[model samples]
Target: MTRKTLILIAAGGSALLMLGALGFQYIGQMPPCKLCYWQRYPHIAAIAIGLVALWLPGRLLPGAGALAALTTAGIGFYHTGVERKWWLGPESCSSQPITGLSTDDLLSQIMTAPVVRCDEPPFVLLGLSMASWNVVASMLLALIWLQALRKS
Candidate 1:
């Protein structure tokens, strides 16, 4: 396939994912956790890379896009691990028991706790969460980037 086609596929795929995320947030009443938000940055970067790749005549942008995809995919894997309780997430988002807190302190902790957490996925499909789907999609986008680089 042509470089232009590859760019469209990669960028369009990222755009679609972003839209889906937004839809889940607004329409489906699903709020993303800290890690979920973290996974989006690389896809945004990849979209920018795709736009730059369209005008540039080199492999750098595609390589960067591949890196971006891999970054998100890695984050997704980490998120999956957190969701599955394989590892601890961030301290701020992770809930810890108040061992020696007074009533006032316990109340404050409860008041300040986040409604959404990285350890629990709001939705799952076919035994795969959104993070897992992102891993799969991002890897596919990475493959498209590699193919674009090969064509170049």
Candidate 2:
């Protein structure tokens, strides 16, 4: 395939993923956790890189796109681990010890705690959570970006 085609596929994949995430948030009434938001930044960067790569004549932007995809994929893997209890997530969006806190402090903490916890998978499909899906998809997009780099 042409470099342009590969770029489009890579960038368009990120766009679709972002749209699905938004749909889950607004339409499905599922709020994103801290890690969920972290996974999105790289996709946004990849989309911008792809758009610029189309007009520019160099491998730099394509390489950046690949990096962006891989970054998001890594974040997705981390998020999956968090959801599976394999590792701890951020304290702000995950459970913490309630020990050694005054009653008022505990109550305040409870009130300020995030509604969406990173450790809990809001939705699962085919035994995999959304983070897992993001990892799969982002890796594929990264491959497309690499192909575009080669073509460039």
lDDT accuracy of residue 78 in candidate 2 = 97
Query: What's the C-alpha lDDT at position 88 in model 1?
Result: 89
Clashes of 1: 0
Best by TM-score: 2
- Cα lDDT of all candidates, in order? 0.90, 0.93
- Expressed as tens digits, the lDDT of each residue in 1-152 for candidate 1 is 89989988998899899999999999998988888899999999999989989999898888899999999999999999999999988876534566989999899988986688888899999999999999999999999988888877
TM-score of 1: 0.87
Give residue 18's lDDT in candidate 1 (0 to 100). 91
Window of ten residues with lowest summed lDDT in model 2:
89-98
Q: What is the TM-score of each candidate against the true structure?
A: 0.87, 0.87
Model 2, 1-152: lDDT tens per residue? 99999999999999999999999999999989989999999999998998999899889999999999999999999999999999988888735566999999999988986588899999999999999999999999999999999999
Q: Which candidate is the best by lDDT?
A: 2
